[model samples]
Target chain A: MTFTGLVGRVFMLPLRLIINTCVRLRIHPNTLTFIGVLINIAAAWALALGKFVTAGLIMVVANIFDFIDGKVAVELGEVSQFGGFWDSVIDRFSDLSLFIGLIYLYSQLGRTDYVMITALAMMFAIMTSYTRARAESIIKKCKVGFMERPERIVLFMIGAFTNRMAAVMWVILVLSVFTVADRIILTYRELRDARQVAA
Target chain B: MKRAASLPARVLWNAFYWTYERATWQYDLMVIAILAFVWLTPPDWLNDPMASGCGPLGWVLAQLR
Candidate 1:
């Protein structure tokens, strides 16, 4: 096995057991997804309260749930378009909540600049996902960006834990905007090529 | 005017599709990084609302505060 594969196997051993138990409980993956978002709401609450460490730790646990739902879905053969659609919708909400928390804290701190930047980051972050979804509507596959959701979550986690949110906002803003642009260009090219070939 | 895929277009396509294929693994690495950073960073350091102890981040936060 490759190094990451080996590591994933080792790490997932426990998660696999948890998922098996979750499956036995007959819990829907969507339920797990819902639970994860609720936990993330708690994380956002922590952030708004200026409890950075608390927020970070809670976010860590919350994302572990985020990862688990997929495994549970795959293991139980519950993967469906509806399931995926709901998960994506919920994920956007989850991302927004976290950014809202950060914005709240920034506003409280009277960092109007950071607050605006954070708002911009949140908007572009949503656009990052939106561009892909919209592109996928017309193209075969629209997975063309580096600043996708999971990376944004990780970057936010880093900023929260390390108290480097300014750095996080800058990264999110630049990369998310770039990602949106990348998707637009990629989809445009793909459609144009398709039209040319058909013609 | 229509032509074959240019070198730059081909390069971009390959790079993006390659990235797409390995996106899961990349996400895994980022998760590991976040967890490791959280574990290593002291609670006090992380809990500093104003980031008063970090380097540039702290300086920026201090200015904002």
Candidate 2:
């Protein structure tokens, strides 16, 4: 087995247990998804309120829900186009809420500089996801980027736990911009290749 | 959109399909770095007095006082 696969399985053990319990409860995946977003909003609220440790802990719980929702859906045989769409849309709102919290916190601290930096980070983060989604609509898959949602979430948790949010913002801004560019380039290259093949 | 596959097949496919693929050793190293940073970083570094102390509501209260 691959090294990452082994690590992934070890990490997923607890999550699998949770997924099983949720499955036995016969809970709807959409409900789980809804609950996840609500928890994320609470995490954002905590972040805005300067409860950094509490926010980090809450975000861990929130991401557990995010990670398992699709698994629960598949287990329940409840995967649908709408389920996918709902998950994607709710994710955007969740991402926006976290950035809003950071922006609000910075503004409250009278740090206009960090507020602008956080806003730019947020914009690039959204663009990272948007570019992939838009490119995927044309291409079969547009998973060319290195800084995907999982990486971003991990970085957020790290920032919150370490109180290194300023550093985290800069990292997110740079990596997300690169990710956005990577996706656009991938789409362009793929389209050009397709046209050549057709010609 | 189409439910052509059986439940088991669908589950198996979804398992691989949805999970993010971290193909390289660098990805694993990155994960390790994150875990290390979270656990090992000193509290003093990047410590923001304003952020860690008074929240928005507290700031507002201070303003009124």
Model 2, A1-199: lDDT tens per residue? 6677786789899999999999999899999888989999999999898787888999999999888989999999999999999999988888889999988998898988888888999999999889988998999988865678888887888789877777677667866777787778779989999999999
Write down the C-alpha DockQ for each prediction: 0.16, 0.09
**Candidate 2 TM-score over all chains jointly:** 0.80
Best by TM-score: 2
A101: Cα error in model 1, Å = 0.4
Give the DockQ-based CAPRI class for model 2: incorrect
Whole-model lDDT, model 2: 0.79
Which residue pairs in candidate 2 collide? none
The reply for model 2, stretches above 4 Å from the true place, is A1-6, B1-20, B30-65
Q: Of the candidates shown, which would achieve the greatest lDDT relative to the real structure?
A: 2
DockQ of 1: 0.16
In model 1, the runs with Cα more than 4 Å from the true position are A1-10, B1-49, B53-65
- Candidate 1 chain A lowest-lDDT run of ten: A1-10
